[model samples]
Target: MLNFKNIAIRRGNRLLFSKASFIIHKGQKIGLTGANGVGKSSFFALLRGELHSDEGEFSMPPNLEIAHVAQETPALDCTAIDYVLDGDRELRQLQQQLAAAEQAQDGLKQAELHGNLDHIGGYTAQARASRLLNGLGFSTAQEIHPVSSFSGGWRMRLNLAQALMCRSDVLLLDEPTNHLDLDAVIWLQDWLGRYPGTLLLISHDRDFLDAITDHIVHIEQNNAEIYTGNYSDFERMRAEKLSQQQSAFEKQQREIAHIQSFVDRFKAKASKAKQAQSRIKSLERMEIIAQAHVDSPFNFRFPAPKKLPNPLLKIEDADIGYGDKVVIKNASLSITPGDRIGLLGPNGAGKSSLIKVLSGQMRQLNGELHSAESLNIGYFAQHQLEQLRLDESPLWHLQKLDKQASEKDLRNFLGGFDFRGDKVNDPIGPFSGGEKARLVLALLVYQNPNLLLLDEPTNHLDLEMRHALSVALQEYEGALVVVSHDRHLLRSVTDQLLLVANGKLQVFDGDLDDYRLWLAENKKTGDEPAPAAIASPAVRKDERKLEAKRRNTLKPFMDAVKKSEALVDKLQQQQIELESKLADPSLYQEENKESLKTLLAEKSRIDNALHQAEDNWMVAEENLQQAEKSCIN
Candidate 1:
């Protein structure tokens, strides 16, 4: 058991929480939740002995084995499975001792060590490590790969696996699902449910917390309060408490207002001065109730698209993949104006490939893809965050998109995403992942695209931002197709689920719960048979020839489209500059009359040129589409 008595903690000069008292009992799974930088991680540090309370007392069982995922993984040549096995320090120590005993030819010592190994299940440690690796989305083949070979995100998964491999009395996991897919998240959820230990988890994923935790310790306003139930229950209880708080605050305000009014009316008269003084004393004696504040900082909506084509995009008998390697074969999907789709699949199942094809970021290897002329895609993927100019500000990015938009309007829009004040103008290079993700999302939302294809949109977002996004998506009129590990977001925002597996894109027959069951069954049965062998050499040769011919035929039309687009962009920029000059009040003064007239004339000329350029762009785009159709036919 862990007990805290009026604990006060500080990070530098900032007081995180004070007078925090709670008892975390054995075998209890508690979720620590709060806004970012609200001392949840600091609390974990306290448990790990990296920090000490500034006041009062905190106590835990002595020598309690606690396991936590490492934040950084050093590059190592050791195989992944071996690295995970190292989590069991006792098992490793026993093995080393037994090996030394064998080298020394100490038969008696060897026998004693073997008995101890059997008692601790050391013989099966390797198999246990492998299971942890597999459950965290690693393939049997990847288990042999060196730790140094894995990417950063995969390394994080390995760290998680290693932490789970430990047979500890207590476990601490923070944002365990951030780097995982839905299938792996489900697997970890099940694993944690079966873990015979006290678990303290810090996660922004509400569904994960609900599935794994029995109690919630919420930190807010420099206070930590333990609730009796899961995340949903805590939300309900908090809402009710806040409501009562609001009522009391309102009642207090009314009483104060009444007393103030009486004092103002009576204080001027000599006879009523004493009564007014008594009223003032009563007002001073009354305690002020703080107003309830439970509002999310994020509150933005997708602007309505300029045009809503019925079928925004369509794919028929398409094969999506890199050159000669097919990831998704014979895929057929139609996205209309209001389709809400959530994609589900195991890691590396080509869900992202399909999204890329739909977004026109990748060309189909075979078959037809027809996009409406009015289709405006607001595609968001994790990589796009990296594409943002780190040296620039959020306002700069928005102004680049629409220089004609007023600064006030742009700032107001950014404020909805919580990028207000000087923060909007600050360089984003030093921003955290969540801030970068919010900026990416803010840019996407400002585009007013008819189709939204998001790949793991909630990866770095907090609970408040996630809730705000879910609410905004609910009110969105555009078609949304998202691939996210967040089950709560999926359940709230998507009406249909699509399963991507076995090189096929098909509508899932059931919801997320059914999908979870399917994953378990599929694991038992093994992966769907490997995608059918590649086409014959002669057939491949012919397909390559056809692809080359199509590319050759579309080159001129594509070039024309690009040229027209550039011209339109150039003209719009010029127009924006001219309009900006015209907007200055100083330019309208007598001394600047001639300059204003010239600016207005230039603006008129640029507007005409921009209109012509826009028309040319449409013509070129139409020609390109027709050429593509011809090639398809």
Candidate 2:
């Protein structure tokens, strides 16, 4: 368990968080969310002790371990199996120490070895290692591949595998689902749902989070507020909280207005002046909550354009692959102007490569990619930041793209991405992935090209920022081609879908989720689809109602689980303090006898409460399982 107390983060002169307090507990999954550059990742780092805040304290059990997974690690060199197996460092160390002792035939060390082996559950480490490796997206075949040979996305899978293999007390994941395919993501969600350790993950995948996290921590205007539930529940709670705040603010405003009216009328009467003044003083003393408005990062719309004569863009009999290994083969699709298109595909299905070919960054090997005349294109590549010059400042980078732009114009554009003043002057080198993506997007908005291509542009962005981008794209009068695994994003901003799978492009005229379901069907072994397989309308409605009922029934249990999570935090804190005192030999001395007794007593009480809470948590979980089963059948 860990607690972040009174923490503050700054980007240049701007404060990201101030005196924010939050706690993470064992077996709880917490989601950190906010707009881009609002310091969610920074907060994660602060909790992990990777980044220090300018003020306040972070407390955790001294022995509590944390594992953080990045999108990719450039330094990885071992095979994926080695990377995953390396997570069992403690087991490996113990084995080495035991082997050394055995070689020396030291009886005292042998007893220590047996005790350590028994404590670590050494007999089960290997089985756990394999099971975790599979759960986190690594197949047995791929595990033997050298990490260097893997793509950035696959390398990310290795990071996930490693983290799960470690089975640390807490997982501090930054965009853990960024590279995962739907199956892998679902597997991960299920794994986390059943996991006993604590999890704190930042992800843009809505369905994944909706299925997993038990708590949501929203960081807004330099503070954090905790909510209980999944992403959807968090959104509902956020709206309710904001609405409540607005109601309170309105009441305060009305009271102040009434008092002001009374003061204005009674000022001439000397006797009523003191009462009016006291009312005025009361009005002035009322501290209203600031307007908690969330303006997403990108929020611009393009002027509507005339419909295209035919398709805005087209691909004909294309083969997308490296060399002879074709992924998308003989694919053809037409995109109309002003169409919001979602590109769906599994990993290694050539989604990005196809987008690249369509956008003219890469040419097709065997087919023609045709486009309308006078077409202007804007592409948000996966490595859009790589296009930026490292030596240049944020403003300078913007200027590099358009040297004719004035400083005033450039600064205003950067401001849209939440960069301002000295932040605009900050070199590109230190900016986080979200910042870099926003910078690239800011330039794109200014350009306002007719054809926009986006490739997983939402991964690094937080909920608010992604919503902003979605709003902007939704309003844009252009042909959009977005390749992303984010289900919510696709649903929000896309009109239809162009699915790439089995070396082909299959266009679907429906919602993105429907298209996703279609893709899922294509991958399934069953001859009949779920929709077609259901015999009666009663069964279909019952199934739908069942799912809804299960999700609803879990909400109250989640709330109770959240309360127990708080208790766990307090118990962990008490445990840490007790351990610190116990570590000191002076506590056993007669002079410190009373202190020892008190500490021990407090520890015992805390331990008992923690035990009870854990039991309650188990019961809540069992209840949820029963509810889910009932909903299913």
Question: lDDT of model 2 at residue 92?
Answer: 76
Between which residue pairs do clashes occur in model 1? none
Q: What RMSD value applies to candidate 1?
A: 28.1
Off by over 4 Å in 2: 1-23, 35-42, 45-62, 70-77, 97-139, 151-153, 179-183, 204-207, 240-298, 305-309, 393-414, 422-427, 508-633
Question: What is the C-alpha lDDT profile of model 1 across 230-261, one tens digit per residue?
Answer: 88778767765765666555654554464355
Residue 123 C-alpha lDDT in model 2: 42
Worst 10 residues of 2 by lDDT: 285-294
The true-versus-predicted C-alpha distance at residue 434 of model 2, in Å, is 1.8
Q: Give the per-residue lDDT of model 2 (tens digit) for 1-633.
A: 678788778878988888777777768988877765678778777767777878888788887777777454775667776677777678778878977976896534644554565566654454466566655545445555677888777777877877777758888877787677654665577678887888887776666787788898888778877788977777665554654665645744554464355335433432332223433343232222111223234334444554443577888998877775666778787877766677765555588898888888877879888888867788887677787877678887777779988999778767767888898998888887877777788777767677888888876776656655754665576788988767666655565556665455665444534544654574352111223221368976875675466557667765665676577667656655555555566666678868867765776687688778756654664565455334322
Candidate 1 ranges with C-alpha deviation above 4 Å: 245-294, 527-633
TM-score of each: 0.76, 0.66
